[model samples]
Target: MTLHPIESGNFKLDGGAMFGVVPKSLWTRTNPADANNMIDMAARCLLIEDGDRLILIDTGMGDKQSEKFFGYYYMWGDHSLDASLAKAGFHRDDITDVFLTHLHFDHCGGCIINNPNGNGYLPAFKNAKFWTNENHWNWAVNPNAREKASFLKENILPMQDSGQLNFIKKTTKDSFQTSSELDFGIFFADGHTEKQMIPRIDYKGKTLVFAADLLPTAGHIPLPYVMGYDTRPLLTLDEKAQFLNEAADHNHYIFLEHDAHNEIITVQHTDKGVRLKDTYTFNQLFK
Candidate 1:
């Protein structure tokens, strides 16, 4: 099995929003903010090539939203899904599966695109079966007030409407849900959303985790550095603590999706809990 770290795109999010109640003085050390208080973030997705199945985890924010809509989040960077895929020697059509960690716009927006002739939206990876759990699907379709903004309909409904949407049955095995469909185990964390699935893939003797919002960046290594967007901050505290401990103990490598600067990282149990031990580019370790 070969893994490709896909750089879908990059954007800026408010450092305060990204760091939650954590004061700027602390988070700034790792994730320095710009003049506007926006911190750099990357819509970094992962692509796994195993046999004939090319599985993509999380589609970054697509290029469909209106200028005004995208103005909210300061979009920057030259990287794109197509360009990244080409660099990795593949295309969207080659993807046989798309496992979404969650339904947030930045995470799943690239799932759909404006059809030819500039009309209605359609699935970007028409050949791939979109994956999301039943609980997350229901929660996203019927979103709460706090999460409605993040769960854009255009980025989501098209998957189900296209008849390509599929659910990953959560076969609870130990702490994670084992899915025979993909080569990874998913650990569901409700703190970030209804059921954000964090993929744990064993590749080349190292356990690589797709640290979605559960651990967005190295700056979020601290237990209290939860995102303001998280529906349940307190729940995040518990879930993150457990995950970090396990990652540190098992020497698992974390594939950060939103950290623009740090791509992959590993944490160690420090006096202050699990702290970022080292960081690596995808090629540095994966190669």
Candidate 2:
């Protein structure tokens, strides 16, 4: 099995929003903000090439929103979902499975796109089965007031409408095991969003975790650095503490979805608590 880092693109978001209650003086060092207090973020997704299946985890924000809508977040960068796939000698049609960590626009927007001739939304990966948990699917579709904005209908409804959506059955087991070469086990965390599935993949004997929004960047390594967008902030603290302990214990590498500067981070149990030990690009591990 071969794993490829597919960079969808880069966009800017309010540092305060990204870092939550964390102070500017603190998070700014790791993610320097612009005059608008917005920090650049990467919509980095992962692609796994196994024998017959090419699985893509999280599709970056697609270029379908209106100008006014896009004005809120400034997007910059040459990377694109299609372009990155082409670079990997593949196309959208080549994908067989799209495993979505969650339904947030930045994470799954690229899964659906405007159809040709402007009919309506269509599946971005025409040949892939979109995978999302039943709980997350229900939570996103029937979103609460706090999360309504992040769960954009344009980025979600099309999947179910296209008849390509499938739910990963919730198993009673502690860890979800996959027979595929990805060697990923889905771990559900409710703090960030309801039933947010973090893919823990064992690649080349090293456990690599797709941190999603649970741990967006290295700046979020501190136990208290929780996102403002999380539904249950206190639960996030508990979840992070537990997850970090496990990651550190197992020497797992965290794949950050939004950190424009650092793609992957390893944690260490420090005197102050859990802290980032090393930061590197995703490919660094494979190398």
Candidate 3:
């Protein structure tokens, strides 16, 4: 099995919102803010080529939103979903499965796109099945007031409407194997959302966990560095503490999603609790 890091695009978000209650004096050291106080963020997704199945972890924000709509997020960079797929020697049609960690626009917006005439929407990955759990699907479609803005109907709905949406069965087990050689398990964390599924994959004798929003960047390694967007901040503390302990003990590599600079990182149990041990790009890992 081969894993590829797909660079979709970059955008800027308020550093304060990204870091939550954490003081700017602390987070700024790792993720510096611009004059407008927006921090650089990448919509980095993962692509797994295992035998006949090419699985994409998350689809970054697509370019379908209006300029006024995108103005809110300050989208930047030339990287695009289609361009990234081409670099990997694949196309959207080659993707057999699209495993979404969550339904936030920035994470799954690339799932659908405007049709040829630009009159309606269509599934971006014409032949692939969109994977999202039942709980998250329900939570997203019927979003609460706090998260309503992040879950846009244009970025979603089309998959279900296109008859390509599939739900992973809920299981009590922490991890389970999929139908391919790229077998992976799911780690559900509620602090971030109702049932945010973090894919834990066993690859090349090492375990790689897609950090998703749970640990957005190396700066978020500390237990208290939780995102302010999390609905349950207190619960996030416990989730991070437990996940970090296990990640450190097992020497698992974390694949960061929103970290524009750092792609992957490992943690070690220090006196101050789990801390960043090392950072690497996708190519550096094999070297």
Highest lDDT against the true fold, candidate: 1
In TM-score terms, which candidate is top? 1
Model 3 stretches astray by more than 4 angstroms = 173-182
CA displacement after TM-score superposition, residue 164 of candidate 1 (Å):
0.2
Give candidate 2's TM-score: 0.96
Residue pairs that clash (backbone atoms under 3 angstroms), model 3: none
- Model 3, range 1-287, lDDT digits (tens) per residue? 89999999999999999999999999999999999999999999999998888999999988888899889888887898899999989999999999999999999999988998968999989989899889899999999999999999988899899999998877565433352323687888889888888889888888999989999988898888989899999999988988899899999999999999999999998888999999999898854
List, residue by residue over 1-287, the lDDT tens digit for candidate 2.
88898999998998898778889999898889999999888999999998898999999988888898878989897999999999989999999999999999999989988988898888988998999988899999999999999999989999999899998887665534452433468878889999888898878988888989889888888988888888999999988988899988888999998888898889999889988888887667787
Which lDDT tens digits does candidate 1 get at residues 1-287? 99999999999999999999999999999999999999999999999999989999998999999999889889898999999999999999999999999999999999999988877889999899999989899999999999999999999999989999999887774558778777678999989898899999999989999999999989998999999999999999999999999999999999999999999999999888889899999889968
- Candidate 2, pairs of clashing residues: none
Worst-scoring 10-residue span by lDDT in model 3: 173-182
C-alpha-based local distance difference test score of model 3: 0.90
